[model samples]
Target: MQVGGKSQTTWQPLGWTGASGGGRVGERRWRLVDVAASAGISTQQVRNYLADGLLPPAGRTPSGYRMFTERHVRALAVARRMAEGHGWARTREVLAAVHRGELPAALAALDAGHAELDRERAEIARVLGAFETVLDSPAAAVPRRDARIGVVAAQVGVRTSQLRLWEQRGLLRPHRQRGTGYRVYDVAEWRAAQVVALLRRGGYPFDIITAVLDELRSTGRPDRVRAELARREQDLHARSLRRLRGSAALSDYLAETVPAGTH
Candidate 1:
């Protein structure tokens, strides 16, 4: 990347002519195979990137062979790093900005993505802190076995429809009384309801909650909370690292390309 308005480095494209190599002996073009090898990625992966419009199209020789350059290699490296960091959709945004010659917009997109990650990590930490506070608080007295849906819903501070939706998603299953057919929540169900409520408040996805609940039911593990939160922390840390590397690559690309465009 550039420093103090001066371009730091530029990569020059080179041509090789060898009959045993990817292209014809007299050809000086960089072949697709050569580009893939240089980039340390699969040929199919490069093609997939081209299909995704992440990489610009290659120049074509008279025989219709794809020809790449050092610039293409640099672009591919940046795209790969972005994919590793920000995922497909976010990567596409940054790539599109760069493609349109919007370097600042690309940097802004990276900033936004990382900011979202920071918010999510902070939310997870707050949830964990709240959960610990809940554990330390004295337990409320047990309710009657015939506790109705409305009562449970009020206690959990969620709407009745939300509780029903959770049940519809197979997350909760309160018993239906025989005569009135009203939903009934027992002690065990109340505990499950509390767990679901806390998790939902923490913005956990349905599938993750379902999986954790299933594991809890099958294994009776008391360490599920610690295990799940620990895994989430590790995942966020890894993502942060990816974002850092991706930003570096994008900055380098912008630095090398911007000065050339100015001239």
Candidate 2:
């Protein structure tokens, strides 16, 4: 539906608004709501994107009504998809490249994002390997039940704060010594601490470590840790694939539509 000068209070599907009164693809024009409806976003969101130099500027009607075309719709669509895995800032750079008709730059931005995710996946693998190796070792079977926090930290090469943070987050449950109430790391707890430290060094968030540790403690299976990492790996892999597909789609759009200009 077309709203010439007034803002739309409710959203509706876009309909063709005549700018040249022609049915041809290049001759047709759309209102702001029409573009918003076509893109499945609110008019305010489109305005915000426009202000951020995300959307191409709309042409003005004789009486100052904003006019849009299919090009704008396509731009918004690509912007939304690019924002999914790559953050808004990165998406902005990518979309800017696309809107300026720089397909290579846009695709390069996508490739860079994919490469970063690849590095992240490799790191996850390394961390999971460390966790599994520690779990499988005979040395892990020995109980250093009375080991203090400092000793455990020193042995594992972690800070006391790291251990305390892990314990606070429910990733570890080191026993407290009687009277003194100091933390005492048993064999199992120390192993868990090692796992946490390795994962942290490899860039796993504390919450994810907590969940993986909980699964390990409940199932007593070291493989559960690998399973969690595998799930994350699959998720990142899927997201990377989607970003590539979006890049292809954006390339197609850039090929067809001319960019407004450099922002």
TM-score of 1: 0.65
Residue 95 in candidate 2, Cα distance off native in Å? 1.1
Report the Cα lDDT for residue 95, model 1: 75
TM-score of 2: 0.62
Candidate 2: the clashing residue pairs are none
CA RMSD of each candidate after superposition: 8.4, 10.0
- lDDT of model 2 at position 157: 83
State residue 60's C-alpha deviation in candidate 1, in Å. 4.0
| Candidate 1 root-mean-square deviation in Å | 8.4
Off by over 4 Å in 1: 1-29, 40-44, 61-65, 143-173, 192-222, 260-263
Q: Model 1: per-residue lDDT, tens digit, 2-84?
A: 76998764322223222223322354456788878987888998888766656655666567677765666777888888889
